[model samples]
Target: MNGTIHNRDKFLNQIASRLNRPRISSKIQKPKWKYQPQHEVYKDATQDELLAVLEEHCKKIHTDIFTTDLQGLPAVVNDVVANCGGGPVVTWKDERFSEWGLDSVMKKEWPSQQIDVFEWDHTLGEENIDKAENANVGITISEITLAESGTVVLFSDKDKGRTVSFLPKASIMLIPKSTLVPRMTQAAVKMREVYQKTGHVASCINFITGPSNSADIELNLVVGVHGPIKATYIVVNDL
Candidate 1:
């Protein structure tokens, strides 16, 4: 920590000396908004209302959504995988898969059907990334869901490789309905809460709305230019 601060100060001091000004080491204060408009959208909305907002936004982003309860979650996952043309699937090695009661689905169920499944293993190094890149679909659990933009926030870990979501042809996000928020405002609050509790936060926090869309070439819209060609969100109501 001391070395990091020293290096930062040295870099800043060089710039200050070049500009003929004293180095400012104090932290900047965040601006306080008078109206606080960011917190107002769907402030009192129920979970169902948030889901409605997410459903509408998904259409704009060309993503599909499926709602199911805990008991039906396994079926939903299976159907989504099938719809994405069966896998070669890559997923995060997260305990939440079992915690949310889908352990059998990931292990026994899929394997029995002859669908290849790969879990991101840090021990395997870059081999995990290669599997994800070659897979038909990547499955991940959403840390937070932003309803206003149909976005899923992911905090990357060693077991949760960043490539799993972006490298696959299609990405599957398993979102628990209770994780839904009205917009980015609440999501930001949640992230701050995570940081406060852990004393640190993930360096790679992703806010993915849908598949990659680009028009850089000749003003024509194209999908899958920079990421997955298809994206699906499976919202578990009782998870």
Candidate 2:
């Protein structure tokens, strides 16, 4: 009878506690990086295979290309855009982009005339986002990464707003091949340290593997339903 009464008291206490639970949530800052379950370092993969893997994982074929060096930018962009039927490519204003000789590539290539290239300025306001989404391709250069999960990090200060990377149907990210890291943990540590020293949290740190995708409906996988349909990265070493 004593044991039964003890159990009854414990249940009553739990019920009372639940009834008087606090209304406000704590303001604790969680870890900056979200750990993806399948986050593992892909090894011994060729560039072609890497591209193939990204495409396979995202379930969408992308003609968009990413390159870090200001030099190979033209070739990669031309190759990817031409493959995608030479549609308009929207890019932000940057000296590196100009150094890539994008103008020459545009003028010399037969497809350039068919494609419209727009340079974005901050003055465009929110409406530019809609224009980027409607365009055939969106291209931007990345800072660099250290080649573990094939992750690319974007800082919001680059003027290529976070939306520029995510909102488009196809995103082309160019990173210096040297930026690849071997693990997600290393990336997280670096990010944390940076925040500690700077005292300013990175406005955005987007880790885009390929394209945005989901498989939630009756286990039926779908691609490009919610976000971009495709993503491509050109690990440029020449820059």
Candidate 3:
């Protein structure tokens, strides 16, 4: 115990001596102001125009398009699959979605359980991930995300499971208009608001930009390396 105390004292004295020995004077550092400037005033087009923009962008990116009327999502999902291709495995967990009439919307030839809706608990160890990865289509509802950069923010809570977005062939996300922020900085501000109010931190937070892509080997851009090959973002205007 005596030797340990002496070692601690020696460390403290060394730190103090180093602090006291700094004698060189330097000019005060000027703050870096606005490295990247943001727009002074924000302007958005009409709802129809915005939807048109989204559709055009999605088409250019070769993403299967879908929209949620917020009245009945299960029905909308049916059209989304039919538009993409028949026989897609629609995986959803929300009870409301299940109740929104999925069984009836599916085609007769498709198996009864092809559209599998399971109630998932995040506590379940890696099982949901396996299910999502095997699925052809995965659906999720985001709390909010930035529309401009096409970024989807998953809060990584019990309801918004991580695998829902990450481990699927294709992702279909439903984001309410009330939660849509324009830019990345706004996303941080919204997160801060939640932190200040709830005092609750998440287990994980993911910011997904488009589909999983990589250019590791031969410097050639490759898609679907880490996650889904295709992603569809459905911005629900009505919250």
Residues 163-202 of candidate 3 have per-residue lDDT tens digits of 7776767777776666666557777778888899998767
Which numbered prediction scores highest in TM-score against the true structure? 1
lDDT of 1 at 60: 97
TM-score of 3: 0.69
Worst 10 residues of 3 by lDDT: 36-45
Model 1 quality (TM-score):
0.90
lDDT of model 1 at position 42: 97
Relative to the true structure, candidate 2 reaches a TM of 0.64
Model 2: lDDT equals 0.63
lDDT of each: 0.92, 0.63, 0.64
- The per-residue C-alpha lDDT of model 3 at residue 112 equals 59
Residues 57-162 of candidate 2 have per-residue lDDT tens digits of 3333332434345665677777876765565667766666656577776555634366766666677787667767777777776653434445577766545656
Please report how far candidate 3 places residue 165 from its true position, in Å: 0.9
